[model samples]
Target: MPSNDNTPRADRQELAYLPVPFPKAPPKEPRFAALRTWWQEAWEEDGVLRAMWEDVLSAPEDGFRYMAPWLRAVLMVAGVSFIVLMAKAAGEVVLEGLHQLLTAVPKVQVGGDTSSGVFAVVDQPVRTYIAQHSAGLPVAASTVYTLWLLTGITGLVLGYLSRNNGVRAMWAGWGAASVFMVWTATPATSRPIAVGLAVLAWTVLSAFAMRGLTLRRRVGRPARPARVSVKPEIHVHVPAPAPAPVVEQHPHSGCPFRD
Candidate 1:
Protein backbone atom coordinates (compact mmCIF):
# COMPACT_ATOMS: atom_id res chain seq x y z
CA MET A 1 0.00 0.00 0.00
CA PRO A 2 1.26 3.45 -0.89
CA SER A 3 1.83 5.76 2.08
CA ASN A 4 -0.50 8.78 2.40
CA ASP A 5 2.30 10.80 4.09
CA ASN A 6 4.84 12.95 2.25
CA THR A 7 7.86 10.85 3.36
CA PRO A 8 8.99 7.93 1.14
CA ARG A 9 7.35 4.57 1.92
CA ALA A 10 10.79 3.07 2.73
CA ASP A 11 11.59 5.88 5.19
CA ARG A 12 8.10 5.62 6.77
CA GLN A 13 8.44 1.89 7.36
CA GLU A 14 8.43 1.08 11.09
CA LEU A 15 11.53 -0.87 12.26
CA ALA A 16 11.01 -3.65 14.82
CA TYR A 17 14.37 -3.72 16.61
CA LEU A 18 12.92 -5.15 19.82
CA PRO A 19 11.90 -8.79 20.19
CA VAL A 20 8.35 -9.50 19.06
CA PRO A 21 6.08 -10.64 21.89
CA PHE A 22 5.75 -14.43 21.71
CA PRO A 23 2.06 -15.33 21.60
CA LYS A 24 1.60 -13.87 25.11
CA ALA A 25 3.55 -16.91 26.48
CA PRO A 26 0.38 -18.77 27.52
CA PRO A 27 0.54 -16.99 30.91
CA LYS A 28 3.28 -18.90 32.70
CA GLU A 29 2.24 -20.49 36.00
CA PRO A 30 3.73 -19.09 39.20
CA ARG A 31 6.76 -21.03 40.42
CA PHE A 32 5.55 -21.34 44.01
CA ALA A 33 1.99 -22.28 43.13
CA ALA A 34 2.91 -25.93 42.93
CA LEU A 35 4.72 -25.77 46.26
CA ARG A 36 1.78 -24.01 47.91
CA THR A 37 -0.63 -26.59 46.46
CA TRP A 38 1.54 -29.45 47.67
CA TRP A 39 1.72 -27.95 51.16
CA GLN A 40 -2.05 -27.65 51.30
CA GLU A 41 -2.52 -31.18 50.03
CA ALA A 42 0.00 -32.63 52.43
CA TRP A 43 -1.70 -30.86 55.33
CA GLU A 44 -5.12 -32.35 54.54
CA GLU A 45 -6.83 -34.31 57.35
CA ASP A 46 -6.18 -37.75 55.85
CA GLY A 47 -2.90 -36.93 54.10
CA VAL A 48 0.25 -39.04 54.59
CA LEU A 49 2.29 -36.16 55.97
CA ARG A 50 -0.47 -35.25 58.40
CA ALA A 51 -0.68 -38.84 59.64
CA MET A 52 3.07 -39.00 60.09
CA TRP A 53 3.05 -35.76 62.04
CA GLU A 54 0.31 -37.10 64.29
CA ASP A 55 2.13 -40.36 64.86
CA VAL A 56 5.35 -38.61 65.79
CA LEU A 57 3.52 -36.30 68.14
CA SER A 58 1.72 -39.15 69.90
CA ALA A 59 4.53 -41.76 69.99
CA PRO A 60 6.17 -42.25 73.35
CA GLU A 61 9.87 -41.63 73.78
CA ASP A 62 11.67 -44.82 74.88
CA GLY A 63 15.01 -45.38 76.55
CA PHE A 64 17.71 -47.06 74.42
CA ARG A 65 18.17 -50.80 75.05
CA TYR A 66 21.51 -52.52 74.44
CA MET A 67 20.11 -55.98 73.74
CA ALA A 68 22.68 -58.30 72.16
CA PRO A 69 24.77 -55.31 71.08
CA TRP A 70 27.88 -57.45 70.51
CA LEU A 71 26.05 -59.99 68.38
CA ARG A 72 24.30 -57.26 66.42
CA ALA A 73 27.54 -55.43 65.76
CA VAL A 74 29.27 -58.59 64.54
CA LEU A 75 26.29 -59.42 62.33
CA MET A 76 26.25 -55.94 60.76
CA VAL A 77 29.98 -56.10 59.96
CA ALA A 78 29.65 -59.55 58.44
CA GLY A 79 26.54 -58.53 56.49
CA VAL A 80 28.25 -55.52 54.95
CA SER A 81 31.28 -57.61 53.91
CA PHE A 82 29.07 -60.27 52.37
CA ILE A 83 27.09 -57.72 50.40
CA VAL A 84 30.34 -56.28 49.05
CA LEU A 85 31.53 -59.73 47.95
CA MET A 86 28.27 -60.44 46.15
CA ALA A 87 28.51 -57.09 44.38
CA LYS A 88 32.01 -57.99 43.18
CA ALA A 89 30.78 -61.32 41.83
CA ALA A 90 27.90 -59.67 39.97
CA GLY A 91 30.19 -56.97 38.59
CA GLU A 92 32.59 -59.62 37.30
CA VAL A 93 29.82 -61.15 35.21
CA VAL A 94 28.08 -57.92 34.09
CA LEU A 95 31.09 -55.66 33.63
CA GLU A 96 33.01 -58.59 32.08
CA GLY A 97 35.52 -56.85 29.76
CA LEU A 98 34.70 -53.32 30.98
CA HIS A 99 36.09 -54.17 34.41
CA GLN A 100 39.53 -54.82 32.88
CA LEU A 101 39.03 -51.96 30.47
CA LEU A 102 38.78 -49.60 33.46
CA THR A 103 42.09 -50.94 34.80
CA ALA A 104 43.94 -49.63 31.73
CA VAL A 105 43.08 -46.06 32.79
CA PRO A 106 45.38 -44.82 35.57
CA LYS A 107 42.53 -43.20 37.51
CA VAL A 108 40.70 -46.55 37.62
CA GLN A 109 43.69 -48.21 39.29
CA VAL A 110 42.46 -50.42 42.17
CA GLY A 111 45.71 -50.51 44.16
CA GLY A 112 49.37 -49.49 43.99
CA ASP A 113 50.88 -52.89 45.01
CA THR A 114 49.36 -55.80 43.05
CA SER A 115 52.10 -58.47 43.40
CA SER A 116 50.61 -60.33 46.37
CA GLY A 117 47.38 -60.76 48.38
CA VAL A 118 43.85 -60.99 47.00
CA PHE A 119 44.73 -59.04 43.85
CA ALA A 120 47.26 -61.67 42.75
CA VAL A 121 44.85 -64.60 42.61
CA VAL A 122 41.59 -62.78 41.88
CA ASP A 123 41.06 -62.06 38.18
CA GLN A 124 44.54 -63.46 37.38
CA PRO A 125 43.41 -64.84 34.00
CA VAL A 126 41.36 -61.77 33.10
CA ARG A 127 44.21 -59.52 34.21
CA THR A 128 46.52 -61.32 31.79
CA TYR A 129 44.00 -60.93 29.01
CA ILE A 130 43.68 -57.22 29.85
CA ALA A 131 47.47 -56.80 29.55
CA GLN A 132 48.00 -58.82 26.34
CA HIS A 133 44.90 -57.60 24.54
CA SER A 134 45.45 -53.91 25.25
CA ALA A 135 47.74 -51.53 23.32
CA GLY A 136 50.34 -50.74 25.98
CA LEU A 137 47.88 -49.69 28.70
CA PRO A 138 49.69 -49.61 32.07
CA VAL A 139 47.89 -51.57 34.79
CA ALA A 140 48.31 -51.15 38.54
CA ALA A 141 46.68 -54.10 40.33
CA SER A 142 46.92 -52.56 43.79
CA THR A 143 45.21 -49.35 42.71
CA VAL A 144 41.99 -51.19 41.84
CA TYR A 145 42.03 -53.06 45.13
CA THR A 146 42.60 -49.86 47.12
CA LEU A 147 39.75 -48.12 45.34
CA TRP A 148 37.37 -50.95 46.24
CA LEU A 149 38.45 -50.89 49.90
CA LEU A 150 37.92 -47.12 50.12
CA THR A 151 34.47 -47.40 48.53
CA GLY A 152 33.34 -50.11 51.01
CA ILE A 153 34.56 -48.10 54.01
CA THR A 154 32.83 -44.99 52.76
CA GLY A 155 29.58 -46.87 52.16
CA LEU A 156 29.74 -48.49 55.62
CA VAL A 157 30.13 -45.10 57.27
CA LEU A 158 27.29 -43.55 55.25
CA GLY A 159 24.96 -46.47 55.95
CA TYR A 160 25.59 -46.17 59.67
CA LEU A 161 24.83 -42.46 59.56
CA SER A 162 21.61 -42.91 57.60
CA ARG A 163 19.74 -44.88 60.26
CA ASN A 164 19.29 -44.12 63.96
CA ASN A 165 17.72 -47.47 64.79
CA GLY A 166 20.17 -50.36 65.26
CA VAL A 167 18.25 -52.92 63.19
CA ARG A 168 17.67 -50.44 60.37
CA ALA A 169 21.28 -49.37 60.50
CA MET A 170 22.42 -52.96 60.05
CA TRP A 171 20.36 -53.31 56.92
CA ALA A 172 21.29 -49.92 55.55
CA GLY A 173 24.95 -50.67 56.13
CA TRP A 174 24.73 -53.96 54.22
CA GLY A 175 22.87 -52.37 51.28
CA ALA A 176 25.41 -49.57 51.01
CA ALA A 177 28.31 -52.03 51.32
CA SER A 178 26.98 -54.07 48.39
CA VAL A 179 27.23 -51.00 46.14
CA PHE A 180 30.96 -50.61 46.84
CA MET A 181 31.64 -54.36 46.63
CA VAL A 182 30.87 -54.33 42.90
CA TRP A 183 34.29 -52.83 42.13
CA THR A 184 36.37 -55.34 44.10
CA ALA A 185 35.27 -58.99 44.04
CA THR A 186 35.92 -61.67 41.46
CA PRO A 187 33.76 -64.79 41.00
CA ALA A 188 35.48 -67.56 42.97
CA THR A 189 34.80 -70.75 44.92
CA SER A 190 37.01 -69.61 47.80
CA ARG A 191 35.16 -68.58 50.98
CA PRO A 192 32.00 -70.43 49.98
CA ILE A 193 30.79 -70.31 53.56
CA ALA A 194 31.28 -66.55 53.68
CA VAL A 195 29.54 -66.21 50.32
CA GLY A 196 26.56 -68.22 51.61
CA LEU A 197 26.38 -66.04 54.72
CA ALA A 198 26.45 -62.93 52.54
CA VAL A 199 23.53 -64.14 50.43
CA LEU A 200 21.44 -64.74 53.57
CA ALA A 201 22.46 -61.43 55.15
CA TRP A 202 21.73 -59.43 51.99
CA THR A 203 18.28 -60.98 51.58
CA VAL A 204 17.17 -60.08 55.11
CA LEU A 205 19.04 -56.79 55.50
CA SER A 206 18.22 -55.41 52.07
CA ALA A 207 14.50 -56.11 52.46
CA PHE A 208 14.36 -54.16 55.72
CA ALA A 209 16.60 -51.44 54.35
CA MET A 210 14.34 -50.88 51.35
CA ARG A 211 11.31 -50.50 53.60
CA GLY A 212 13.12 -48.12 55.95
CA LEU A 213 14.40 -45.98 53.11
CA THR A 214 11.11 -45.79 51.28
CA LEU A 215 8.69 -45.47 54.19
CA ARG A 216 10.77 -43.84 56.88
CA ARG A 217 12.44 -40.94 55.09
CA ARG A 218 10.50 -38.49 57.24
CA VAL A 219 11.43 -40.39 60.39
CA GLY A 220 15.14 -39.68 59.91
CA ARG A 221 14.69 -36.09 58.77
CA PRO A 222 15.42 -33.34 61.30
CA ALA A 223 12.44 -31.91 63.15
CA ARG A 224 10.95 -28.90 61.42
CA PRO A 225 10.81 -25.66 63.35
CA ALA A 226 7.32 -24.75 64.62
CA ARG A 227 5.58 -22.17 62.45
CA VAL A 228 5.16 -18.85 64.25
CA SER A 229 2.04 -17.20 62.84
CA VAL A 230 1.82 -13.45 63.33
CA LYS A 231 -1.76 -12.24 63.30
CA PRO A 232 -2.34 -8.51 62.62
CA GLU A 233 -4.22 -6.81 65.47
CA ILE A 234 -6.67 -4.06 64.55
CA HIS A 235 -7.16 -1.02 66.84
CA VAL A 236 -10.00 1.52 66.63
CA HIS A 237 -10.27 4.89 68.50
CA VAL A 238 -13.51 6.96 69.05
CA PRO A 239 -12.86 10.70 69.21
CA ALA A 240 -12.69 12.02 72.81
CA PRO A 241 -16.10 10.75 74.23
CA ALA A 242 -18.31 13.49 72.71
CA PRO A 243 -18.24 15.81 75.75
CA ALA A 244 -19.90 13.23 78.15
CA PRO A 245 -23.55 13.80 77.15
CA VAL A 246 -24.30 17.24 78.59
CA VAL A 247 -26.97 17.39 81.34
CA GLU A 248 -29.69 19.99 80.89
CA GLN A 249 -30.39 22.32 83.81
CA HIS A 250 -33.62 21.40 85.71
CA PRO A 251 -36.01 24.35 85.92
CA HIS A 252 -37.92 22.86 88.91
CA SER A 253 -35.07 22.16 91.34
CA GLY A 254 -31.31 21.80 91.74
CA CYS A 255 -31.35 18.16 90.63
CA PRO A 256 -29.84 17.15 87.32
CA PHE A 257 -31.14 14.30 85.07
CA ARG A 258 -29.31 10.95 85.79
CA ASP A 259 -30.66 8.82 82.86
Candidate 2:
Protein backbone atom coordinates (compact mmCIF):
# COMPACT_ATOMS: atom_id res chain seq x y z
CA MET A 1 0.00 0.00 0.00
CA PRO A 2 1.19 3.43 -0.93
CA SER A 3 1.74 5.86 1.92
CA ASN A 4 -0.97 8.52 2.08
CA ASP A 5 1.63 11.16 3.02
CA ASN A 6 5.34 10.57 2.80
CA THR A 7 8.34 12.81 2.19
CA PRO A 8 9.86 10.08 0.05
CA ARG A 9 8.80 6.44 -0.47
CA ALA A 10 12.40 5.32 -0.92
CA ASP A 11 13.29 6.78 2.53
CA ARG A 12 10.27 4.99 4.01
CA GLN A 13 11.13 1.78 2.12
CA GLU A 14 14.55 1.62 3.73
CA LEU A 15 13.89 -0.76 6.64
CA ALA A 16 16.88 0.46 8.60
CA TYR A 17 15.70 4.10 8.47
CA LEU A 18 11.95 3.36 8.53
CA PRO A 19 9.89 4.42 11.53
CA VAL A 20 8.29 0.96 11.82
CA PRO A 21 8.93 0.05 15.44
CA PHE A 22 10.50 -3.27 16.32
CA PRO A 23 7.83 -5.26 18.10
CA LYS A 24 8.02 -4.78 21.85
CA ALA A 25 7.05 -8.11 23.32
CA PRO A 26 4.83 -7.66 26.36
CA PRO A 27 6.62 -8.19 29.63
CA LYS A 28 6.73 -11.92 30.31
CA GLU A 29 4.57 -13.09 33.18
CA PRO A 30 7.31 -14.51 35.31
CA ARG A 31 5.04 -16.26 37.73
CA PHE A 32 5.67 -19.63 39.36
CA ALA A 33 2.41 -21.56 39.75
CA ALA A 34 3.83 -24.47 41.68
CA LEU A 35 2.39 -23.39 45.03
CA ARG A 36 -1.07 -22.90 43.60
CA THR A 37 -1.44 -26.25 41.84
CA TRP A 38 1.21 -28.39 43.51
CA TRP A 39 -0.65 -29.11 46.73
CA GLN A 40 -3.90 -29.77 44.92
CA GLU A 41 -2.37 -32.11 42.36
CA ALA A 42 0.10 -33.81 44.69
CA TRP A 43 -2.31 -36.60 45.50
CA GLU A 44 -3.41 -37.37 41.93
CA GLU A 45 -0.91 -39.86 40.53
CA ASP A 46 2.19 -40.26 42.67
CA GLY A 47 2.37 -43.97 43.39
CA VAL A 48 6.00 -44.29 42.34
CA LEU A 49 7.05 -41.21 44.28
CA ARG A 50 5.05 -42.32 47.32
CA ALA A 51 6.73 -45.71 47.34
CA MET A 52 10.15 -44.14 47.05
CA TRP A 53 9.44 -41.71 49.89
CA GLU A 54 8.08 -44.53 52.07
CA ASP A 55 11.18 -46.61 51.47
CA VAL A 56 13.35 -43.66 52.36
CA LEU A 57 11.39 -43.09 55.54
CA SER A 58 11.39 -46.80 56.43
CA ALA A 59 15.19 -47.26 56.63
CA PRO A 60 15.82 -50.51 58.47
CA GLU A 61 17.55 -51.57 61.74
CA ASP A 62 21.12 -50.32 62.05
CA GLY A 63 24.50 -52.00 62.81
CA PHE A 64 25.44 -55.69 63.29
CA ARG A 65 21.89 -56.80 63.95
CA TYR A 66 21.03 -55.67 60.43
CA MET A 67 23.15 -58.40 58.89
CA ALA A 68 25.61 -61.22 59.46
CA PRO A 69 29.30 -60.38 60.00
CA TRP A 70 30.23 -61.67 56.57
CA LEU A 71 27.75 -59.26 54.94
CA ARG A 72 29.18 -56.33 56.90
CA ALA A 73 32.60 -56.70 55.31
CA VAL A 74 31.04 -56.99 51.89
CA LEU A 75 28.97 -53.86 52.57
CA MET A 76 31.97 -51.83 53.76
CA VAL A 77 33.90 -52.70 50.62
CA ALA A 78 30.90 -51.81 48.47
CA GLY A 79 30.43 -48.55 50.37
CA VAL A 80 34.01 -47.58 49.64
CA SER A 81 33.50 -48.34 46.00
CA PHE A 82 30.25 -46.35 45.77
CA ILE A 83 31.87 -43.40 47.52
CA VAL A 84 34.78 -43.42 45.11
CA LEU A 85 32.50 -43.40 42.11
CA MET A 86 30.32 -40.66 43.61
CA ALA A 87 33.33 -38.45 44.26
CA LYS A 88 34.72 -39.09 40.82
CA ALA A 89 31.46 -38.13 39.15
CA ALA A 90 31.02 -35.04 41.34
CA GLY A 91 34.51 -33.76 40.59
CA GLU A 92 34.30 -34.44 36.88
CA VAL A 93 30.79 -33.09 36.39
CA VAL A 94 30.44 -30.32 38.99
CA LEU A 95 33.94 -28.92 39.34
CA GLU A 96 35.94 -29.61 36.19
CA GLY A 97 33.05 -29.79 33.77
CA LEU A 98 31.56 -26.50 34.95
CA HIS A 99 34.87 -24.70 34.62
CA GLN A 100 35.37 -26.01 31.10
CA LEU A 101 31.81 -25.21 30.07
CA LEU A 102 31.90 -21.63 31.43
CA THR A 103 35.27 -21.07 29.81
CA ALA A 104 34.21 -22.38 26.41
CA VAL A 105 30.75 -20.76 26.28
CA PRO A 106 32.08 -17.22 26.73
CA LYS A 107 34.87 -17.85 24.19
CA VAL A 108 32.25 -19.00 21.65
CA GLN A 109 31.16 -16.50 18.99
CA VAL A 110 27.47 -15.58 19.10
CA GLY A 111 26.55 -17.20 15.80
CA GLY A 112 24.84 -20.40 14.72
CA ASP A 113 25.31 -20.77 10.97
CA THR A 114 27.51 -22.57 8.47
CA SER A 115 29.87 -19.59 8.84
CA SER A 116 30.02 -20.25 12.63
CA GLY A 117 29.27 -23.62 14.19
CA VAL A 118 29.98 -25.32 17.48
CA PHE A 119 33.01 -27.62 17.36
CA ALA A 120 35.24 -28.73 20.17
CA VAL A 121 32.77 -26.98 22.51
CA VAL A 122 34.59 -28.71 25.31
CA ASP A 123 36.92 -31.59 24.65
CA GLN A 124 34.70 -34.67 25.17
CA PRO A 125 32.58 -33.07 27.87
CA VAL A 126 29.83 -35.70 28.22
CA ARG A 127 28.42 -38.08 25.66
CA THR A 128 25.53 -38.95 27.94
CA TYR A 129 23.25 -37.09 30.39
CA ILE A 130 25.33 -38.47 33.24
CA ALA A 131 25.68 -35.78 35.94
CA GLN A 132 24.42 -33.19 33.47
CA HIS A 133 21.96 -31.80 36.03
CA SER A 134 24.83 -29.82 37.49
CA ALA A 135 24.57 -27.32 34.64
CA GLY A 136 20.94 -26.45 35.42
CA LEU A 137 20.81 -26.92 39.20
CA PRO A 138 22.55 -24.72 41.73
CA VAL A 139 25.72 -26.41 42.98
CA ALA A 140 24.53 -26.61 46.60
CA ALA A 141 21.03 -27.86 45.73
CA SER A 142 22.49 -30.43 43.40
CA THR A 143 24.82 -31.68 46.11
CA VAL A 144 22.02 -31.99 48.67
CA TYR A 145 19.80 -33.64 46.09
CA THR A 146 22.55 -36.15 45.33
CA LEU A 147 22.88 -36.93 49.03
CA TRP A 148 19.14 -37.35 49.54
CA LEU A 149 18.84 -39.46 46.41
CA LEU A 150 21.59 -41.81 47.51
CA THR A 151 20.09 -42.11 50.97
CA GLY A 152 16.63 -42.79 49.62
CA ILE A 153 17.88 -45.38 47.18
CA THR A 154 19.77 -47.04 50.03
CA GLY A 155 16.81 -47.15 52.40
CA LEU A 156 14.45 -48.47 49.72
CA VAL A 157 16.76 -51.29 48.66
CA LEU A 158 17.53 -52.32 52.25
CA GLY A 159 13.85 -52.46 53.12
CA TYR A 160 13.39 -54.92 50.27
CA LEU A 161 16.63 -57.01 50.55
CA SER A 162 15.91 -58.61 53.97
CA ARG A 163 13.92 -61.70 51.26
CA ASN A 164 11.87 -59.39 49.23
CA ASN A 165 12.58 -60.46 54.30
CA GLY A 166 15.39 -62.78 51.92
CA VAL A 167 14.63 -60.14 49.19
CA ARG A 168 17.79 -60.59 51.83
CA ALA A 169 19.71 -57.68 50.29
CA MET A 170 21.45 -54.94 52.29
CA TRP A 171 24.64 -53.78 54.07
CA ALA A 172 25.60 -52.04 50.84
CA GLY A 173 22.78 -49.71 49.75
CA TRP A 174 21.87 -48.84 53.35
CA GLY A 175 25.21 -47.48 54.48
CA ALA A 176 26.53 -46.70 51.04
CA ALA A 177 25.03 -43.21 51.10
CA SER A 178 26.45 -42.36 54.53
CA VAL A 179 29.89 -43.64 53.66
CA PHE A 180 29.73 -41.78 50.40
CA MET A 181 28.97 -38.52 52.20
CA VAL A 182 31.70 -39.16 54.77
CA TRP A 183 34.19 -39.96 52.07
CA THR A 184 33.17 -36.89 50.14
CA ALA A 185 33.14 -34.46 53.04
CA THR A 186 36.29 -35.77 54.71
CA PRO A 187 38.76 -37.40 52.38
CA ALA A 188 40.26 -40.69 53.51
CA THR A 189 43.65 -38.98 53.60
CA SER A 190 42.39 -36.71 56.39
CA ARG A 191 39.79 -38.60 58.48
CA PRO A 192 39.75 -42.38 58.08
CA ILE A 193 37.40 -42.91 61.05
CA ALA A 194 34.61 -41.12 59.24
CA VAL A 195 34.75 -43.93 56.74
CA GLY A 196 34.67 -46.50 59.55
CA LEU A 197 31.74 -44.87 61.36
CA ALA A 198 29.98 -44.70 58.04
CA VAL A 199 30.47 -48.46 57.95
CA LEU A 200 28.15 -48.83 60.94
CA ALA A 201 25.43 -46.65 62.57
CA TRP A 202 24.51 -48.36 65.91
CA THR A 203 23.15 -51.87 66.49
CA VAL A 204 21.36 -51.89 63.15
CA LEU A 205 21.51 -50.90 59.42
CA SER A 206 24.57 -53.08 58.78
CA ALA A 207 23.74 -54.14 55.25
CA PHE A 208 24.00 -51.56 52.43
CA ALA A 209 22.85 -53.06 49.14
CA MET A 210 23.84 -55.28 46.17
CA ARG A 211 23.01 -56.56 42.73
CA GLY A 212 20.45 -59.31 42.46
CA LEU A 213 20.44 -58.39 38.78
CA THR A 214 21.47 -61.95 38.05
CA LEU A 215 17.87 -62.89 38.81
CA ARG A 216 16.66 -60.67 35.95
CA ARG A 217 18.30 -62.91 33.32
CA ARG A 218 15.16 -65.02 33.02
CA VAL A 219 11.94 -63.21 31.99
CA GLY A 220 9.39 -65.85 31.05
CA ARG A 221 8.81 -67.86 34.20
CA PRO A 222 5.69 -69.91 33.60
CA ALA A 223 3.99 -70.58 36.91
CA ARG A 224 3.52 -74.25 37.62
CA PRO A 225 0.05 -75.39 38.66
CA ALA A 226 -0.07 -76.47 42.28
CA ARG A 227 -0.36 -80.25 42.56
CA VAL A 228 -2.62 -81.05 45.54
CA SER A 229 -2.42 -84.79 46.23
CA VAL A 230 -5.81 -85.77 47.62
CA LYS A 231 -5.81 -89.29 49.02
CA PRO A 232 -9.08 -91.29 48.60
CA GLU A 233 -11.47 -90.65 51.57
CA ILE A 234 -11.40 -93.65 53.93
CA HIS A 235 -14.90 -94.22 55.31
CA VAL A 236 -14.90 -96.69 58.29
CA HIS A 237 -18.55 -97.42 58.73
CA VAL A 238 -19.22 -98.26 62.46
CA PRO A 239 -22.67 -99.76 62.85
CA ALA A 240 -24.90 -97.84 65.29
CA PRO A 241 -25.28 -99.69 68.60
CA ALA A 242 -28.26 -102.13 68.33
CA PRO A 243 -31.17 -100.84 70.38
CA ALA A 244 -31.31 -102.74 73.69
CA PRO A 245 -34.00 -105.38 73.37
CA VAL A 246 -36.85 -104.00 75.37
CA VAL A 247 -38.48 -106.78 77.32
CA GLU A 248 -42.12 -106.60 76.59
CA GLN A 249 -43.75 -105.23 79.71
CA HIS A 250 -46.29 -107.77 80.80
CA PRO A 251 -49.44 -105.97 81.89
CA HIS A 252 -49.94 -108.52 84.69
CA SER A 253 -46.28 -109.06 85.72
CA GLY A 254 -45.36 -105.44 86.52
CA CYS A 255 -41.72 -105.93 87.40
CA PRO A 256 -39.89 -102.52 86.97
CA PHE A 257 -36.60 -104.23 85.75
CA ARG A 258 -38.46 -106.08 82.93
CA ASP A 259 -38.48 -103.11 80.54
How many clashes in each candidate?
12, 26
Tens digit per residue, CA lDDT, model 1, 83-177: 99999999888787666645654654332234464434433433433333344445454444444444444544544556446646554554445
lDDT of 2 at 83: 100
Worst 10 residues of 1 by lDDT: 59-68
- Lowest summed lDDT across 10 adjacent residues in model 2 is found at 120-129
Question: What TM-score do all the candidates reach, one by one?
Answer: 0.23, 0.22
Judging by lDDT against the true structure, name the best candidate.
1
Candidates' lDDT values, in order?
0.54, 0.49
Off by over 4 Å in 2: 1-143, 146-162, 165-171, 187-190, 207-259
lDDT of 2 at 2: 71
List per-candidate RMSD values in Å.
26.7, 30.5
User: How close to the true structure is residue 5 of candidate 2, measured as C-alpha lDDT?
Assistant: 83
lDDT of 1 at 183: 24
Which candidate has the highest TM-score of all? 1
lDDT of 1: 0.54
